[model samples]
Target: MASVYKSLSKTNGSKEDGPANGVKKNKQRVLILSSRGITYRHRHLLNDLASLLPHGRKDAKLDTKSKLYQLNELAELYNCNNVFFFEARKGKDLYLWMSKAPNGPTVKMHMQNLHTMEELHFTGNCLKGSRPILSFDSKFDTEPHLRVLKELFLHIFGVPKGARKSKPFVDHVMGFTLADGKIWIRNYQINETEASKVTSADVEEGLKKKEKRDKTGGGKETEISLVEIGPRFVLTPIVIQEGSFGGPIIYENKEFVSPNQVRSEIRLKKAGRYNARAEQGIERLAKKGELGLRTSGGRAPKKDELDTAELFA
Candidate 1:
Protein backbone atom coordinates (compact mmCIF):
# COMPACT_ATOMS: atom_id res chain seq x y z
CA MET A 1 0.00 0.00 0.00
CA ALA A 2 2.88 2.38 0.80
CA SER A 3 4.55 1.46 -2.49
CA VAL A 4 1.31 2.28 -4.40
CA TYR A 5 1.09 5.68 -2.71
CA LYS A 6 4.70 6.39 -3.59
CA SER A 7 4.10 5.47 -7.22
CA LEU A 8 1.06 7.75 -7.42
CA SER A 9 2.99 10.61 -5.89
CA LYS A 10 5.86 10.06 -8.28
CA THR A 11 3.53 10.18 -11.27
CA ASN A 12 1.92 13.35 -9.96
CA GLY A 13 5.31 15.00 -9.52
CA SER A 14 6.37 14.01 -13.01
CA LYS A 15 3.36 15.66 -14.61
CA GLU A 16 4.32 18.94 -16.32
CA ASP A 17 2.39 21.78 -17.92
CA GLY A 18 3.25 20.84 -21.48
CA PRO A 19 1.80 19.01 -24.41
CA ALA A 20 1.56 15.26 -24.28
CA ASN A 21 3.38 12.63 -26.34
CA GLY A 22 6.77 14.11 -25.30
CA VAL A 23 6.61 17.15 -27.59
CA LYS A 24 8.72 20.01 -26.31
CA LYS A 25 7.72 23.64 -25.97
CA ASN A 26 9.04 26.33 -28.29
CA LYS A 27 11.71 27.64 -25.96
CA GLN A 28 14.79 29.00 -27.68
CA ARG A 29 17.73 31.01 -26.39
CA VAL A 30 20.31 32.39 -28.79
CA LEU A 31 24.02 33.10 -28.42
CA ILE A 32 24.96 36.25 -30.32
CA LEU A 33 28.58 37.13 -31.00
CA SER A 34 30.93 38.36 -33.66
CA SER A 35 34.52 37.78 -34.74
CA ARG A 36 37.15 40.24 -33.53
CA GLY A 37 37.75 42.23 -36.72
CA ILE A 38 34.25 43.58 -37.26
CA THR A 39 33.90 47.27 -38.00
CA TYR A 40 31.74 49.83 -36.24
CA ARG A 41 28.81 49.29 -38.56
CA HIS A 42 28.87 45.55 -38.02
CA ARG A 43 29.02 46.03 -34.29
CA HIS A 44 26.12 48.44 -34.36
CA LEU A 45 24.06 46.04 -36.40
CA LEU A 46 24.88 43.29 -33.95
CA ASN A 47 23.82 45.49 -31.08
CA ASP A 48 20.59 46.41 -32.82
CA LEU A 49 19.74 42.78 -33.37
CA ALA A 50 20.74 41.88 -29.83
CA SER A 51 18.53 44.60 -28.42
CA LEU A 52 15.61 43.22 -30.33
CA LEU A 53 16.15 39.73 -28.99
CA PRO A 54 15.45 39.53 -25.29
CA HIS A 55 16.34 35.87 -25.05
CA GLY A 56 19.71 36.32 -26.76
CA ARG A 57 23.00 36.28 -24.87
CA LYS A 58 25.63 38.62 -26.28
CA ASP A 59 29.23 37.71 -25.65
CA ALA A 60 32.58 39.37 -26.26
CA LYS A 61 34.26 39.29 -29.64
CA LEU A 62 35.27 35.80 -30.64
CA ASP A 63 39.05 35.51 -30.88
CA THR A 64 39.29 33.04 -33.70
CA LYS A 65 37.59 32.58 -37.05
CA SER A 66 39.10 29.30 -38.22
CA LYS A 67 37.64 27.00 -35.58
CA LEU A 68 34.01 28.07 -35.83
CA TYR A 69 32.82 24.78 -34.35
CA GLN A 70 33.86 26.28 -31.04
CA LEU A 71 30.61 28.19 -31.29
CA ASN A 72 28.68 25.04 -30.51
CA GLU A 73 30.53 24.62 -27.25
CA LEU A 74 29.94 28.27 -26.44
CA ALA A 75 26.26 27.90 -27.16
CA GLU A 76 26.12 24.85 -24.95
CA LEU A 77 27.83 26.81 -22.21
CA TYR A 78 25.26 29.57 -22.43
CA ASN A 79 22.39 27.06 -22.68
CA CYS A 80 21.51 28.54 -26.04
CA ASN A 81 19.90 26.51 -28.78
CA ASN A 82 20.69 28.94 -31.59
CA VAL A 83 23.81 30.81 -32.59
CA PHE A 84 23.91 34.14 -34.43
CA PHE A 85 27.42 34.99 -35.50
CA PHE A 86 28.86 37.90 -37.46
CA GLU A 87 32.13 37.20 -39.23
CA ALA A 88 34.10 40.14 -40.62
CA ARG A 89 36.66 39.68 -43.37
CA LYS A 90 39.19 42.18 -44.79
CA GLY A 91 37.77 44.67 -42.26
CA LYS A 92 34.99 45.47 -44.71
CA ASP A 93 32.95 42.42 -45.61
CA LEU A 94 30.52 40.98 -43.09
CA TYR A 95 29.12 37.47 -43.14
CA LEU A 96 26.31 36.22 -40.96
CA TRP A 97 26.06 32.68 -39.66
CA MET A 98 22.96 31.12 -38.22
CA SER A 99 22.95 27.65 -36.81
CA LYS A 100 21.09 25.30 -34.56
CA ALA A 101 23.81 24.66 -32.06
CA PRO A 102 25.05 21.15 -31.34
CA ASN A 103 23.36 20.02 -34.54
CA GLY A 104 23.33 20.29 -38.31
CA PRO A 105 22.26 22.63 -41.11
CA THR A 106 24.12 25.87 -40.63
CA VAL A 107 23.68 28.84 -42.94
CA LYS A 108 26.33 31.33 -44.00
CA MET A 109 25.20 34.49 -45.71
CA HIS A 110 26.95 37.62 -46.92
CA MET A 111 25.41 40.69 -45.37
CA GLN A 112 25.18 43.82 -47.49
CA ASN A 113 23.72 47.32 -47.38
CA LEU A 114 23.15 47.14 -43.63
CA HIS A 115 21.86 50.24 -41.87
CA THR A 116 21.55 50.56 -38.14
CA MET A 117 18.44 51.92 -36.48
CA GLU A 118 20.21 55.07 -35.32
CA GLU A 119 21.39 55.74 -38.85
CA LEU A 120 17.97 55.27 -40.42
CA HIS A 121 16.23 57.89 -38.24
CA PHE A 122 12.86 56.27 -38.69
CA THR A 123 9.97 57.82 -36.81
CA GLY A 124 8.50 54.48 -35.90
CA ASN A 125 9.41 53.02 -32.53
CA CYS A 126 8.21 50.17 -30.33
CA LEU A 127 8.72 48.94 -26.83
CA LYS A 128 12.09 47.28 -26.59
CA GLY A 129 11.92 43.46 -26.30
CA SER A 130 8.34 43.43 -27.48
CA ARG A 131 7.28 40.45 -29.54
CA PRO A 132 7.28 40.95 -33.29
CA ILE A 133 5.11 39.37 -35.94
CA LEU A 134 7.18 37.70 -38.63
CA SER A 135 5.92 38.41 -42.13
CA PHE A 136 7.49 36.27 -44.85
CA ASP A 137 7.10 36.55 -48.58
CA SER A 138 5.29 33.83 -50.43
CA LYS A 139 8.48 32.89 -52.18
CA PHE A 140 9.89 31.27 -49.04
CA ASP A 141 7.56 28.34 -49.48
CA THR A 142 8.47 27.81 -53.11
CA GLU A 143 11.81 26.03 -52.72
CA PRO A 144 13.52 23.61 -50.33
CA HIS A 145 16.50 25.76 -49.48
CA LEU A 146 14.31 28.79 -49.00
CA ARG A 147 12.17 26.79 -46.63
CA VAL A 148 15.27 25.92 -44.64
CA LEU A 149 16.24 29.60 -44.55
CA LYS A 150 12.76 30.52 -43.41
CA GLU A 151 13.01 28.02 -40.58
CA LEU A 152 16.34 29.45 -39.49
CA PHE A 153 14.98 32.97 -39.49
CA LEU A 154 12.00 31.87 -37.48
CA HIS A 155 14.16 30.19 -34.91
CA ILE A 156 16.63 33.02 -34.53
CA PHE A 157 14.28 35.99 -34.80
CA GLY A 158 11.03 34.74 -33.36
CA VAL A 159 10.69 35.57 -29.70
CA PRO A 160 9.05 32.80 -27.75
CA LYS A 161 6.22 33.36 -25.31
CA GLY A 162 7.12 34.31 -21.72
CA ALA A 163 10.65 35.36 -22.60
CA ARG A 164 12.30 36.73 -19.52
CA LYS A 165 12.89 40.27 -20.82
CA SER A 166 10.12 40.48 -23.38
CA LYS A 167 7.25 42.91 -23.11
CA PRO A 168 3.65 41.76 -22.97
CA PHE A 169 2.60 43.59 -26.08
CA VAL A 170 3.25 42.79 -29.72
CA ASP A 171 4.06 46.16 -31.25
CA HIS A 172 6.12 45.44 -34.35
CA VAL A 173 6.52 43.26 -37.40
CA MET A 174 9.62 41.80 -39.02
CA GLY A 175 9.37 41.44 -42.75
CA PHE A 176 11.49 39.10 -44.86
CA THR A 177 11.20 39.28 -48.59
CA LEU A 178 13.14 37.36 -51.23
CA ALA A 179 13.93 39.07 -54.48
CA ASP A 180 16.80 38.83 -56.96
CA GLY A 181 18.32 35.88 -55.08
CA LYS A 182 18.68 37.83 -51.85
CA ILE A 183 16.71 38.28 -48.66
CA TRP A 184 15.70 41.76 -47.57
CA ILE A 185 14.83 42.44 -43.95
CA ARG A 186 12.67 45.22 -42.58
CA ASN A 187 10.99 46.14 -39.31
CA TYR A 188 7.82 48.12 -38.87
CA GLN A 189 5.84 49.44 -35.93
CA ILE A 190 2.21 48.64 -35.45
CA ASN A 191 0.26 51.85 -34.98
CA GLU A 192 -3.29 51.79 -33.75
CA THR A 193 -5.50 54.86 -33.99
CA GLU A 194 -9.20 55.47 -33.44
CA ALA A 195 -10.77 55.06 -36.83
CA SER A 196 -13.11 57.97 -37.46
CA LYS A 197 -15.24 57.69 -40.56
CA VAL A 198 -18.46 59.65 -41.18
CA THR A 199 -20.27 58.83 -44.41
CA SER A 200 -23.48 60.14 -46.03
CA ALA A 201 -25.45 57.20 -44.67
CA ASP A 202 -24.21 57.92 -41.16
CA VAL A 203 -25.32 61.55 -41.54
CA GLU A 204 -28.71 60.36 -42.80
CA GLU A 205 -29.12 58.32 -39.63
CA GLY A 206 -29.77 61.54 -37.70
CA LEU A 207 -26.73 61.05 -35.45
CA LYS A 208 -28.49 58.42 -33.40
CA LYS A 209 -25.27 56.51 -32.64
CA LYS A 210 -23.44 59.77 -31.89
CA GLU A 211 -26.12 60.77 -29.38
CA LYS A 212 -25.88 57.31 -27.80
CA ARG A 213 -22.12 57.63 -27.65
CA ASP A 214 -22.47 61.09 -26.11
CA LYS A 215 -24.58 59.55 -23.37
CA THR A 216 -22.21 56.51 -22.97
CA GLY A 217 -18.83 57.45 -24.54
CA GLY A 218 -17.51 53.93 -24.21
CA GLY A 219 -16.68 52.10 -27.43
CA LYS A 220 -13.87 53.19 -29.81
CA GLU A 221 -12.66 51.47 -32.94
CA THR A 222 -9.04 51.57 -33.97
CA GLU A 223 -7.31 51.13 -37.30
CA ILE A 224 -4.02 49.34 -37.44
CA SER A 225 -1.26 50.70 -39.66
CA LEU A 226 2.36 49.75 -40.12
CA VAL A 227 5.07 52.39 -39.88
CA GLU A 228 8.65 51.73 -40.83
CA ILE A 229 11.04 50.97 -38.00
CA GLY A 230 14.42 50.15 -39.38
CA PRO A 231 17.66 48.35 -39.02
CA ARG A 232 17.40 47.19 -42.57
CA PHE A 233 19.82 44.81 -44.24
CA VAL A 234 20.06 42.38 -47.11
CA LEU A 235 21.49 38.87 -47.06
CA THR A 236 22.79 36.84 -49.95
CA PRO A 237 23.02 33.17 -49.17
CA ILE A 238 26.53 31.85 -49.79
CA VAL A 239 26.49 28.30 -48.52
CA ILE A 240 24.74 25.90 -46.19
CA GLN A 241 26.80 23.54 -44.12
CA GLU A 242 25.75 20.13 -42.89
CA GLY A 243 26.96 20.76 -39.35
CA SER A 244 27.36 23.59 -36.93
CA PHE A 245 29.83 25.77 -38.90
CA GLY A 246 31.47 22.59 -40.17
CA GLY A 247 30.75 19.48 -42.20
CA PRO A 248 30.24 19.24 -45.95
CA ILE A 249 28.46 21.98 -47.78
CA ILE A 250 24.90 21.08 -48.74
CA TYR A 251 24.17 24.12 -50.87
CA GLU A 252 26.45 26.61 -52.58
CA ASN A 253 25.66 29.74 -54.55
CA LYS A 254 27.56 29.45 -57.81
CA GLU A 255 26.37 32.85 -58.98
CA PHE A 256 27.66 34.60 -55.90
CA VAL A 257 30.93 36.47 -56.52
CA SER A 258 33.44 37.35 -53.83
CA PRO A 259 34.08 41.03 -53.09
CA ASN A 260 37.82 40.41 -53.35
CA GLN A 261 37.48 39.14 -56.89
CA VAL A 262 35.32 42.13 -57.81
CA ARG A 263 37.87 44.54 -56.38
CA SER A 264 40.73 42.74 -58.08
CA GLU A 265 38.92 42.90 -61.42
CA ILE A 266 38.46 46.65 -61.04
CA ARG A 267 42.12 47.05 -60.16
CA LEU A 268 43.16 44.95 -63.13
CA LYS A 269 41.03 47.03 -65.44
CA LYS A 270 42.66 50.24 -64.14
CA ALA A 271 46.08 48.67 -64.50
CA GLY A 272 45.24 47.63 -68.04
CA ARG A 273 44.32 51.22 -68.90
CA TYR A 274 47.58 52.49 -67.41
CA ASN A 275 49.56 49.85 -69.28
CA ALA A 276 47.85 50.79 -72.53
CA ARG A 277 48.71 54.49 -71.99
CA ALA A 278 52.33 53.59 -71.26
CA GLU A 279 52.52 51.45 -74.40
CA GLN A 280 51.04 54.27 -76.49
CA GLY A 281 53.63 56.68 -75.11
CA ILE A 282 56.43 54.20 -75.90
CA GLU A 283 55.07 53.77 -79.44
CA ARG A 284 54.99 57.55 -79.93
CA LEU A 285 58.61 57.83 -78.74
CA ALA A 286 59.62 55.03 -81.14
CA LYS A 287 57.89 56.79 -84.05
CA LYS A 288 59.61 60.09 -83.20
CA GLY A 289 63.04 58.35 -83.11
CA GLU A 290 62.33 56.60 -86.46
CA LEU A 291 61.39 59.98 -88.06
CA GLY A 292 64.60 61.58 -86.71
CA LEU A 293 62.44 64.08 -84.82
CA ARG A 294 64.04 63.14 -81.47
CA THR A 295 67.70 63.81 -80.54
CA SER A 296 69.57 60.61 -79.53
CA GLY A 297 72.69 59.99 -77.41
CA GLY A 298 73.08 63.71 -76.58
CA ARG A 299 73.46 64.57 -80.28
CA ALA A 300 73.37 68.29 -81.24
CA PRO A 301 69.91 69.73 -81.80
CA LYS A 302 68.69 69.81 -85.43
CA LYS A 303 68.24 73.32 -86.94
CA ASP A 304 64.76 73.92 -88.38
CA GLU A 305 63.26 76.89 -90.25
CA LEU A 306 61.12 77.64 -87.18
CA ASP A 307 64.07 77.39 -84.75
CA THR A 308 64.73 80.42 -82.51
CA ALA A 309 68.30 80.76 -83.91
CA GLU A 310 67.01 80.84 -87.51
CA LEU A 311 64.18 83.26 -86.64
CA PHE A 312 66.63 85.63 -84.91
CA ALA A 313 69.10 85.38 -87.81
Candidate 2:
Protein backbone atom coordinates (compact mmCIF):
# COMPACT_ATOMS: atom_id res chain seq x y z
CA MET A 1 0.00 0.00 0.00
CA ALA A 2 2.87 2.40 0.85
CA SER A 3 4.58 1.41 -2.42
CA VAL A 4 1.41 2.19 -4.37
CA TYR A 5 1.18 5.66 -2.83
CA LYS A 6 4.94 6.15 -3.34
CA SER A 7 4.70 5.07 -6.98
CA LEU A 8 1.73 7.34 -7.68
CA SER A 9 3.56 10.24 -6.03
CA LYS A 10 6.74 9.45 -8.05
CA THR A 11 5.20 10.76 -11.27
CA ASN A 12 5.96 14.39 -10.54
CA GLY A 13 4.59 15.46 -14.00
CA SER A 14 7.30 18.18 -13.65
CA LYS A 15 10.39 18.49 -11.35
CA GLU A 16 10.50 15.26 -9.23
CA ASP A 17 13.47 16.76 -7.31
CA GLY A 18 12.45 15.88 -3.71
CA PRO A 19 10.84 12.83 -2.11
CA ALA A 20 7.47 12.47 -3.86
CA ASN A 21 5.95 10.60 -0.88
CA GLY A 22 7.28 13.09 1.63
CA VAL A 23 3.80 14.46 2.18
CA LYS A 24 2.45 11.05 3.16
CA LYS A 25 5.41 10.43 5.48
CA ASN A 26 4.64 13.60 7.44
CA LYS A 27 1.09 12.44 8.32
CA GLN A 28 0.34 11.47 11.92
CA ARG A 29 1.29 7.87 12.81
CA VAL A 30 -1.28 5.54 14.40
CA LEU A 31 -1.66 1.98 15.65
CA ILE A 32 -4.96 0.08 15.62
CA LEU A 33 -5.62 -2.54 18.31
CA SER A 34 -8.36 -4.94 19.37
CA SER A 35 -9.00 -7.01 22.50
CA ARG A 36 -10.06 -10.69 22.37
CA GLY A 37 -7.41 -10.70 19.68
CA ILE A 38 -8.06 -8.82 16.48
CA THR A 39 -10.52 -10.53 14.14
CA TYR A 40 -11.16 -10.07 10.43
CA ARG A 41 -13.65 -7.31 11.11
CA HIS A 42 -11.06 -5.33 13.13
CA ARG A 43 -8.61 -5.38 10.23
CA HIS A 44 -11.34 -4.25 7.88
CA LEU A 45 -12.11 -1.30 10.12
CA LEU A 46 -8.40 -0.40 10.44
CA ASN A 47 -7.89 -0.44 6.67
CA ASP A 48 -10.95 1.73 6.11
CA LEU A 49 -9.84 4.16 8.84
CA ALA A 50 -6.31 4.37 7.37
CA SER A 51 -7.79 5.14 3.96
CA LEU A 52 -10.00 7.78 5.54
CA LEU A 53 -7.14 9.49 7.34
CA PRO A 54 -4.73 8.90 4.46
CA HIS A 55 -2.43 11.58 5.75
CA GLY A 56 -1.78 9.37 8.81
CA ARG A 57 0.75 6.53 8.69
CA LYS A 58 -0.47 3.16 10.01
CA ASP A 59 2.46 2.44 12.40
CA ALA A 60 1.13 -1.02 13.21
CA LYS A 61 -1.95 -3.07 12.35
CA LEU A 62 -4.50 -4.60 14.77
CA ASP A 63 -2.97 -5.91 18.02
CA THR A 64 -4.28 -9.09 19.70
CA LYS A 65 -3.21 -8.35 23.27
CA SER A 66 -4.05 -4.69 23.78
CA LYS A 67 -2.39 -4.29 27.19
CA LEU A 68 -1.45 -0.84 28.56
CA TYR A 69 2.35 -1.33 28.60
CA GLN A 70 2.34 -2.65 25.02
CA LEU A 71 0.37 0.41 23.92
CA ASN A 72 2.92 2.70 25.59
CA GLU A 73 5.78 0.84 23.81
CA LEU A 74 4.04 1.10 20.43
CA ALA A 75 3.56 4.85 20.89
CA GLU A 76 7.23 5.26 21.77
CA LEU A 77 8.44 3.06 18.86
CA TYR A 78 6.51 4.93 16.17
CA ASN A 79 6.40 8.35 17.89
CA CYS A 80 2.63 8.01 17.47
CA ASN A 81 0.24 10.37 19.28
CA ASN A 82 -2.98 8.46 18.66
CA VAL A 83 -4.05 4.79 18.81
CA PHE A 84 -7.50 3.24 18.34
CA PHE A 85 -8.51 0.05 20.19
CA PHE A 86 -11.64 -2.07 19.83
CA GLU A 87 -12.88 -4.68 22.26
CA ALA A 88 -15.35 -7.24 20.87
CA ARG A 89 -18.15 -8.40 23.11
CA LYS A 90 -21.00 -10.93 23.06
CA GLY A 91 -23.40 -10.75 20.11
CA LYS A 92 -22.16 -7.78 18.00
CA ASP A 93 -21.34 -5.14 20.60
CA LEU A 94 -17.90 -3.42 20.69
CA TYR A 95 -16.03 -1.20 23.16
CA LEU A 96 -13.90 1.47 21.46
CA TRP A 97 -10.92 3.03 23.24
CA MET A 98 -9.12 5.96 21.61
CA SER A 99 -5.79 6.20 23.45
CA LYS A 100 -4.07 9.58 23.16
CA ALA A 101 -0.33 9.08 23.56
CA PRO A 102 1.97 10.83 26.10
CA ASN A 103 -0.88 11.55 28.53
CA GLY A 104 -3.88 12.82 26.58
CA PRO A 105 -7.42 11.75 27.46
CA THR A 106 -8.60 8.44 25.97
CA VAL A 107 -12.13 8.67 24.61
CA LYS A 108 -13.95 5.41 25.39
CA MET A 109 -17.13 4.30 23.65
CA HIS A 110 -19.28 1.20 23.16
CA MET A 111 -20.98 0.55 19.85
CA GLN A 112 -23.60 -1.99 18.72
CA ASN A 113 -23.00 -3.27 15.15
CA LEU A 114 -20.07 -5.47 14.01
CA HIS A 115 -21.35 -8.29 11.75
CA THR A 116 -23.24 -6.08 9.26
CA MET A 117 -20.32 -4.29 7.56
CA GLU A 118 -20.44 -6.29 4.30
CA GLU A 119 -24.08 -5.51 3.59
CA LEU A 120 -23.57 -1.87 4.61
CA HIS A 121 -22.29 0.69 2.11
CA PHE A 122 -18.64 1.60 2.67
CA THR A 123 -17.72 4.69 0.68
CA GLY A 124 -14.48 6.08 -0.78
CA ASN A 125 -15.16 9.53 0.67
CA CYS A 126 -13.84 10.14 4.19
CA LEU A 127 -16.26 11.01 7.01
CA LYS A 128 -15.02 14.64 7.05
CA GLY A 129 -15.73 15.25 3.38
CA SER A 130 -18.40 17.86 2.58
CA ARG A 131 -20.97 15.37 1.32
CA PRO A 132 -21.11 12.96 4.31
CA ILE A 133 -22.35 9.38 3.85
CA LEU A 134 -25.47 8.15 5.65
CA SER A 135 -27.45 4.92 5.14
CA PHE A 136 -29.84 3.09 7.48
CA ASP A 137 -30.78 -0.60 7.50
CA SER A 138 -34.56 -0.96 7.43
CA LYS A 139 -34.47 -4.00 9.78
CA PHE A 140 -32.53 -3.28 13.05
CA ASP A 141 -32.62 0.47 12.36
CA THR A 142 -35.82 0.68 14.43
CA GLU A 143 -36.92 1.95 17.89
CA PRO A 144 -34.78 1.90 21.12
CA HIS A 145 -31.51 1.56 19.17
CA LEU A 146 -32.62 4.24 16.74
CA ARG A 147 -33.86 6.45 19.56
CA VAL A 148 -30.70 5.92 21.66
CA LEU A 149 -28.54 6.50 18.59
CA LYS A 150 -30.24 9.86 18.00
CA GLU A 151 -29.50 11.03 21.55
CA LEU A 152 -25.91 9.77 21.37
CA PHE A 153 -25.17 11.55 18.06
CA LEU A 154 -26.72 14.82 19.25
CA HIS A 155 -24.46 14.92 22.32
CA ILE A 156 -21.28 13.85 20.49
CA PHE A 157 -21.49 16.38 17.64
CA GLY A 158 -22.36 19.25 20.01
CA VAL A 159 -25.66 19.58 18.16
CA PRO A 160 -28.81 20.47 20.08
CA LYS A 161 -31.25 17.63 20.72
CA GLY A 162 -33.85 20.03 19.28
CA ALA A 163 -31.84 19.55 16.03
CA ARG A 164 -30.10 22.91 15.90
CA LYS A 165 -26.47 23.59 15.00
CA SER A 166 -25.26 25.39 18.12
CA LYS A 167 -22.10 26.35 16.25
CA PRO A 168 -21.54 26.99 12.53
CA PHE A 169 -18.36 24.84 12.37
CA VAL A 170 -20.33 21.65 13.19
CA ASP A 171 -22.94 22.41 10.52
CA HIS A 172 -22.36 19.11 8.74
CA VAL A 173 -23.38 15.79 10.37
CA MET A 174 -22.46 12.26 9.15
CA GLY A 175 -24.44 9.41 10.59
CA PHE A 176 -26.17 6.10 9.74
CA THR A 177 -27.73 3.10 11.56
CA LEU A 178 -26.84 -0.62 11.14
CA ALA A 179 -28.63 -3.89 11.96
CA ASP A 180 -25.93 -5.50 14.10
CA GLY A 181 -25.14 -2.20 15.90
CA LYS A 182 -22.34 -0.35 14.03
CA ILE A 183 -22.86 3.30 13.07
CA TRP A 184 -21.21 5.31 10.25
CA ILE A 185 -21.69 9.06 10.30
CA ARG A 186 -22.09 11.80 7.62
CA ASN A 187 -23.21 15.44 7.37
CA TYR A 188 -26.84 16.39 6.76
CA GLN A 189 -28.15 18.51 3.88
CA ILE A 190 -31.39 20.43 4.18
CA ASN A 191 -34.36 19.04 2.24
CA GLU A 192 -35.66 21.11 -0.71
CA THR A 193 -39.28 20.67 0.34
CA GLU A 194 -40.89 24.12 0.26
CA ALA A 195 -42.66 25.86 3.14
CA SER A 196 -45.62 26.33 0.73
CA LYS A 197 -46.18 22.58 1.13
CA VAL A 198 -47.58 23.35 4.64
CA THR A 199 -51.13 24.64 4.54
CA SER A 200 -52.51 27.56 6.58
CA ALA A 201 -54.53 25.11 8.70
CA ASP A 202 -51.34 23.25 9.57
CA VAL A 203 -49.75 26.51 10.75
CA GLU A 204 -52.82 27.29 12.87
CA GLU A 205 -52.75 23.80 14.44
CA GLY A 206 -49.00 24.19 15.19
CA LEU A 207 -49.55 27.59 16.86
CA LYS A 208 -52.26 26.16 19.14
CA LYS A 209 -49.96 23.36 20.25
CA LYS A 210 -47.10 25.83 20.84
CA GLU A 211 -49.40 28.06 22.92
CA LYS A 212 -50.45 25.06 25.01
CA ARG A 213 -46.81 24.07 25.54
CA ASP A 214 -45.80 27.63 26.55
CA LYS A 215 -48.52 27.69 29.16
CA THR A 216 -47.85 24.19 30.50
CA GLY A 217 -44.09 23.74 29.79
CA GLY A 218 -44.78 20.19 28.59
CA GLY A 219 -42.86 18.02 26.10
CA LYS A 220 -45.24 19.29 23.42
CA GLU A 221 -43.50 22.68 23.82
CA THR A 222 -40.70 21.02 21.84
CA GLU A 223 -43.10 19.63 19.25
CA ILE A 224 -42.33 20.66 15.68
CA SER A 225 -43.16 24.32 15.25
CA LEU A 226 -39.98 25.97 14.02
CA VAL A 227 -38.50 24.09 11.02
CA GLU A 228 -35.00 25.66 10.85
CA ILE A 229 -33.70 22.64 12.83
CA GLY A 230 -35.37 19.28 13.48
CA PRO A 231 -34.14 17.86 10.17
CA ARG A 232 -36.10 14.80 9.04
CA PHE A 233 -33.02 12.74 8.07
CA VAL A 234 -30.22 11.06 10.06
CA LEU A 235 -27.25 13.09 11.47
CA THR A 236 -23.52 12.23 11.45
CA PRO A 237 -20.80 12.05 14.09
CA ILE A 238 -18.02 14.64 14.51
CA VAL A 239 -14.58 13.81 13.12
CA ILE A 240 -11.63 13.51 15.56
CA GLN A 241 -8.42 15.10 14.23
CA GLU A 242 -4.89 15.08 15.77
CA GLY A 243 -6.27 12.95 18.62
CA SER A 244 -8.13 16.10 19.63
CA PHE A 245 -11.88 16.75 19.28
CA GLY A 246 -11.49 20.31 17.95
CA GLY A 247 -15.11 21.35 17.71
CA PRO A 248 -16.54 24.64 19.00
CA ILE A 249 -15.83 25.42 22.66
CA ILE A 250 -18.71 24.23 24.83
CA TYR A 251 -21.44 26.90 25.57
CA GLU A 252 -19.89 29.03 22.76
CA ASN A 253 -17.46 30.13 25.48
CA LYS A 254 -13.70 29.55 25.39
CA GLU A 255 -13.28 30.85 28.97
CA PHE A 256 -15.52 32.07 31.75
CA VAL A 257 -16.08 35.73 32.70
CA SER A 258 -14.06 36.77 35.77
CA PRO A 259 -16.03 36.85 39.02
CA ASN A 260 -15.28 40.58 39.41
CA GLN A 261 -16.64 41.31 35.93
CA VAL A 262 -19.99 39.74 36.73
CA ARG A 263 -22.00 42.57 38.32
CA SER A 264 -25.31 41.34 39.71
CA GLU A 265 -28.34 43.59 40.08
CA ILE A 266 -28.12 43.56 43.86
CA ARG A 267 -24.50 44.68 43.77
CA LEU A 268 -25.29 47.43 41.26
CA LYS A 269 -28.13 48.70 43.47
CA LYS A 270 -25.89 48.75 46.51
CA ALA A 271 -23.13 50.59 44.63
CA GLY A 272 -25.62 53.17 43.32
CA ARG A 273 -26.90 53.80 46.84
CA TYR A 274 -23.38 54.19 48.24
CA ASN A 275 -22.44 56.65 45.49
CA ALA A 276 -25.63 58.64 46.01
CA ARG A 277 -25.07 58.90 49.80
CA ALA A 278 -21.43 59.97 49.31
CA GLU A 279 -22.52 62.70 46.89
CA GLN A 280 -25.22 63.79 49.33
CA GLY A 281 -22.75 63.94 52.20
CA ILE A 282 -20.38 66.15 50.15
CA GLU A 283 -23.32 68.37 49.15
CA ARG A 284 -24.33 68.79 52.79
CA LEU A 285 -20.75 69.63 53.83
CA ALA A 286 -20.36 72.16 50.97
CA LYS A 287 -23.70 73.86 51.89
CA LYS A 288 -22.38 74.43 55.42
CA GLY A 289 -18.79 75.27 54.26
CA GLU A 290 -17.47 72.14 56.01
CA LEU A 291 -15.91 70.55 52.89
CA GLY A 292 -12.29 71.81 52.82
CA LEU A 293 -11.41 74.66 50.33
CA ARG A 294 -14.78 75.27 48.58
CA THR A 295 -14.97 78.13 46.04
CA SER A 296 -17.06 81.22 46.85
CA GLY A 297 -19.64 80.09 44.20
CA GLY A 298 -20.27 76.88 46.30
CA ARG A 299 -18.54 74.61 43.77
CA ALA A 300 -15.73 72.23 44.93
CA PRO A 301 -12.23 73.80 44.66
CA LYS A 302 -9.92 72.70 41.87
CA LYS A 303 -7.07 70.23 42.63
CA ASP A 304 -4.63 73.19 42.32
CA GLU A 305 -6.09 74.68 45.51
CA LEU A 306 -5.61 71.34 47.44
CA ASP A 307 -1.85 71.11 46.48
CA THR A 308 -2.03 67.30 46.32
CA ALA A 309 1.41 67.13 44.66
CA GLU A 310 2.98 69.11 47.58
CA LEU A 311 1.17 66.87 50.14
CA PHE A 312 2.67 63.70 48.52
CA ALA A 313 6.14 65.33 48.56
The C-alpha RMSD of each candidate to the native structure, in angstroms, is: 8.6, 21.4
Q: What is the Cα-based lDDT of residue 103 in candidate 1? A: 88
Worst 10 residues of 1 by lDDT: 198-207
Instruction: Mark the 10 consecutive residues where model 2 has the least summed lDDT.
Output: 226-235
Relative to the unseen true structure, what is the C-alpha lDDT of residue 147 in candidate 2, on a scale of 0 to 100? 43
Question: TM-score for every candidate vs. truth?
Answer: 0.80, 0.33
> For model 2, how does the per-residue alpha-carbon lDDT over 199-279 read when each residue is reduced to its tens digit?
443353564545634654544232222212111221122122222322222212123232234446669988999999999
lDDT of 1 at 142: 99
Q: Any runs in candidate 1 off by more than 4 Å, and if so which?
A: 1-17, 20-22, 197-221, 288-313
lDDT of 1 by residue, 1-313 (tens): 9999999987876684443537777889999999999999999999999999999999999999999999999999999999999999999999999999988689999999999999998777899999999999999999888999999999899999889999999999999999999999999887664556543333434435456346544457554556677899999999999898899999999879988999999999999999999999998887777667786832345679998889999
Q: What is the lDDT of residue 83 in candidate 1?
A: 98
User: Model 1: how far is 169 from its true place, Å?
Assistant: 1.5
**TM-score: model 2 vs. ground truth:** 0.33
**Model 1 score (lDDT):** 0.88
- Find the candidate with the highest lDDT and give its number: 1
